[model samples]
Target: MNLNFITSQISSICSSVWNCIISLDPKVISTIVSIIALAITALTLYANTKNNKKNNFDNLFFHLISLLNKIIISSENNSEKVEITLNDIKKQNKAQLETLKSQKIKEYYEQHKLAVNSRFVELENMYLKIESKKLEKIKKSNNTTDTAVPIRKSEFLSPIDDLDEINTSDRSQVYYSYYQNNTTDEALNYPFDVSDNGIETLLRMTSFKSNPSLAIYNIFNSDGGISQFKANINVLKSEYPQNETIDKINIELSELFLHKNMNIPSEISEDMKKDIVNDILLDNKHGSYFRTVHRILKIILDFSKSEAVLNKYCGILRTQLSERHLIILFYNAQYTDRGKKFKNLVAKMNLWGDNSELDVGANSDAIHFATNNLIWKDKDLKILKEEYVRK
Candidate 1:
């Protein structure tokens, strides 16, 4: 009985009513009313169908668009979240790598520091053993009573007085003489006639023996204890008459010092003189500040040379050479009466290792070598100020 059946029945009734009305009392008005009612019902049915179809299409279209938009938005959000997650992972990895790098550097420094300390200890033990053996040999010779002066201490002392006459540049002449004169197993076994050279050679020799007794022999003769082999230096000069090797060493050192410091008449600079007065005359009461300054100057001169051997032993840490640290290194090389006190402080504070602190407040007279001041004065001044304040 849906809309179609009802509309058909109404139309049929309207037609019948029209005919009835037409037949009765010449009713033109009734026939017109019935015709109008049938027309209105047909129009109503057609309009309802059209509106229902339009509503259905509108709802379907709106729902389809909403679904597509939701999918697109979800995809974009997932992409952004994924990107963020990946970035976080990358950042974490980078942080870990940096941390590991720092740790490796620290560990390497620690190992090297330990090795140096151990080597120093070994040298001390060897020195003690050699002294004891030498004493026993003298006792066995029964020459103890004949000895003019009783031995006050071991021949090898902490530091020997600076021999004004001896120069490293002249060593080749000494070495060549020892090589020529001494063909004995003992002499040939030693590369140089000096005890210090011997000790240094022994430390360095792994498979080959260059000079076994160089360091010990130097120490023995230079210590003012032994009279034997005192003429070794002269003998070496005689054998190598030309002394070409010694000249070469002196010339090389001279050139290096001059070129490195950018100063004039480089040969004059090569004659580095360190005043050891403060060290030798050190008193217990008041301190000598001027001596420290002089020692610092000497260190500066030594380090100014292009081929300074100390830098080579410093290894990678050498690259971190700043003016302040160089001053500290100079301090380390200086001969001072206050060395024991300072060294004690350094030992207690772990100053030889990672926790070491440099006297940053030191005067930066050495900085001119590292940087130019004319163009970058402001920047250089700021850095200098910061270093100067960090004692």
Candidate 2:
């Protein structure tokens, strides 16, 4: 196996074999031939198998790379496709709402009007006949027994009229905000600094602190203190005023923000923004995208024999991904259980690298895979291997 041993044996054998070449020593020549053949075989055995295995491993590595490439490509395409699909869905939703507001309500109002008019006509004709009978009776009885029925005053009110009076401008504005502002271009954000968990935690502060007035101070004391809490509420009230939503989120910040003594009411989901976002995030494409990236990373990570190897493969994968693809990956991993496993793998591998897209503000735009574009700020998906992902 040693190069020196192989070369020395060949050299010594060849030097002796020169005597067989000169003096025509047949036995020495035969022995020399055997020795030469054995040395060559030893050298071949040392080199070929290891090289073959290296080639095979490289082949498999590249194959995984190819699959990763496809996943990234597909994710971008899928995220864009999700955008178109969500727009169509929004338009369909708006159309259905418009139909309910205009067509359905109008049809009901018209049907009620026709039925009421017919009933009124029937009642009038019956009254005329009854009057004739009463007159005959009165004439017959010499007008001795006569009674009068006073008219009841009433007015018809159309359902459409009431709707127009109450919700016309509100409905139009809601439709505009819900459909238009929810688009990928605008970034589909839930209003204010109130996060999904923030809403819940703030609402549940009462359970933590019995005294309502100093509830925020006591509850969020561990988290950056009351100043941070007040700043959060201030941002919430300033950025998203309660009046922006037609159906109004019932968590009155004035009660909690200004009046520190008052209890935090609850999460602000009544406005339907959260529900609308929840609906879009339920797309199957999101799950499928997660699985692909998860599996890709799994294979790479499982195959990796060392930390260096893991970083090498992960770095390669990271280089291959576009910002949109990373956005989709981050979105899936942010929410689901399957994504938890995927996220753990990502953290383990440090796939995003030091200057991750998140670090570089690549997430400033709308995330494509979040059901049209679940708008999150640049900091929303910031995850580092050294630090866990932040909301």
Candidate 3:
């Protein structure tokens, strides 16, 4: 017999023996005892299934705890948060363990930056080439004539140019006049020195050869000529107590009001006019700077017409034709946005009658205005569009 069957038979026999002892009737005891044994076997099978299920649950819980700890550590390392249900934790763990790529990408970025730097050098070289070509043209045109063409100032006007020609004595005259008009109550401290020529000296010292573009760039960007000029005027005012020069400058500024259909106000003082003129004289050559002086003076003369700043300056500067036109051109170079302003300002100035040279751009200012306006014209606007505008 099989061991299991034999064991079952033995249990039945032991039950039969016990029933016979208790009842003293073998037939009745055998039936009741067999039924009880069958019932006990069924109970045993049920208990075994329950214990197997508990063991499986304990193993699963431990596996989930280990996975959750790993996920928490990973999120901390990356400075990010992650949440996962027990079912998905296994898949997420597999994914995170597969690769480490952040360092390789950083190396690639460094290489890309080096490439960009190289390209920048190439672009700079191209600009240098363009400059060299321009120098070659100038050299070719250099001639033996005694009345050779003077170096035409570039379309952009630089104040450094004006400072070159104006000597110490001339600047002193300007400073003396400036001081006399500004200082009324204060005592004069610095007399206009006849020997000091700071403006001229600075200009002589500046060289356009070593780095032509950089030199020009530095001049335009430094001290904003107009603002610096105004500062000097203030310095003069603080030093010189009072003088006739202030009254003269004021009278001249007031006269500018008479030309316009405006009346000079009485409240506008002499000091104010001098200050305004000082500001204008600073840029000396900048159209906007002059324009500012012309307008401010006009406003003081007539408060009601304060909004007429541009109109007044443009109108006045436009009428007085001279080297101012060249100054206007230099200003135009520095401020390309003043194209319409340049045109309007120059148009008002008395133009030469027949000489076409003086007609379109008689001088520097005209050239500055003509170049900007011509390129901005409806038909020829294409070429300069990329240089100045996005659309």
Candidate 4:
């Protein structure tokens, strides 16, 4: 209480004494009244001290609650921003795979890649036209016009072979799956002996007679084959203007096959270099969010001697998280050094408790687990998910 409040209480007590003095028969003698006044003053001072402590306690408590709300809001907003950014990236990746061009797409991807990849239809049609021509040439050269239902064998439909089975909705998923699997765990292993038969001759297939696309591609790529193939492509590119100049790639490949050094490609494109550097970044701006959570935990842990208050607030934190937020948490805790403290704190509190299944995600930390050489027999990253599973 302030000085004025204490003074008013003291004055009210004195006024009662004055009234007693004014009575014809005093309520109490002066000495007794003085002693009673002293006792009342002592009680008033004690009450004020207790009130001050209560006010301070309440101030800290309300401040803690306010901070808790702010942390929760920051987490939600950060998670939403991360989700939006990831969705935009995924859409862009999907669009680029589909060869859907815009200013942004044009800027990110090379024009040659868009041209070569976007027109798989034309490439397949060219394959068919060449196949028909080859059959006609054979018949004319033999001088035989009697062929009953001649089967046009097309085991070489590269573009639509796998794509024919997948629906449009599943195309992106299938394309990416194949795209990601293109890389091997180790370096390139050349088949047979490239030195003995020329690297190009060893790699390319002689049977793909109608088109030399595979032939030229085989020389250059086998996941970026030997340095000689790149040199050969560079030599060929001088005459072709572009290695994959879509208009006459078949012509260039046809020329490539004429030499004993080159044959049909055993692999797909030699240049499977896709850029995704920026997508590796764009993170959750929630470092402050986690720090604040730690402070809240500390406050709760220090609030009482027991674990009751700490568990209560941990429950509060768990309830605040969405599934997306949980995914974010799983990534941070399992992968990042900075998130270790928060992870330990939550684990200690049994934050997920019996609801630990909420923390258990499907391959949520797969990359981290793989990178760390963690075996699946050891539970992988899922072990971390059970950190707070109740006993």
Q: What digit string (tens of lDDT, one per residue) describes model 1 on residues 61-93?
A: 345434433432354323343234324433544
1-391: candidate 4 lDDT, tens digit per residue: 7999999999999999788677735545666778999999999999998789657755775586577566656644465764654455345455554343233233322323434333433444443454456455544554333332222333322334321221222112222211012221122222222121122232333212233344234434344443544443344444346436543654443343342333322212212111221332225455665566667665555554356655566666656565444444544454456667766655666543444333334554332222232212234244554664434
* Count of clashing residue pairs in every prediction: 14, 1, 9, 4
Model 1: per-residue Cα lDDT at residue 380:
29
TM-score of each: 0.16, 0.35, 0.17, 0.33
Model 3 compared with the native: what TM-score? 0.17
* List of clashing residue pairs for candidate 4: 204-264, 205-264, 214-265, 221-270
**Stretches of candidate 4 exceeding 4 Å from the true structure:** 1-62, 71-76, 84-283, 305-307, 355-381
User: Best candidate, lDDT-wise?
Assistant: 2
Task: Tell me which residue pairs clash in candidate 3.
Answer: 157-330, 181-246, 183-241, 229-282, 265-301, 318-349, 326-365, 329-365, 358-362
Q: What are the RMSD figures for all models against the true structure?
A: 32.7, 23.1, 38.5, 20.5
Across 1-391, the per-residue lDDT of candidate 3 in tens digits comes to 6999999999999999777678667776787779899999989988997778656644553454344334334433111221122112224333332221223223332444344233323322332343345435645764434432222122211222221233223233333221222122122223343322222222223343333223322333346532432343343344343734433433432332231322212222334323333343342333333354333333333322332533443344333333333333332322344343433433322221112222333344332234432312332222223222111
lDDT of each: 0.35, 0.45, 0.35, 0.44
- Cα lDDT tens digits, model 2, 1-391, are 9999999999999999776587877787788789999999999987997688667767876786776666545754454765554454356445545444444333433544444333323322333343345334434553323232211111111122121122112122221111121121112222322222232234244332233324333433335444444454454455445534311222332222332332222222223323443455565455555566677677776665577777677667666665556655654455444466766667665554443333443245322222223233333334342443221
In model 2, where is the ten-residue run with the lowest total lDDT? Answer: 150-159
Task: Name model 1 segments beyond 4 Å from true.
Answer: 1-111, 144-391
Top candidate on TM-score is: 2
Q: TM-score of the candidate numbered 1?
A: 0.16
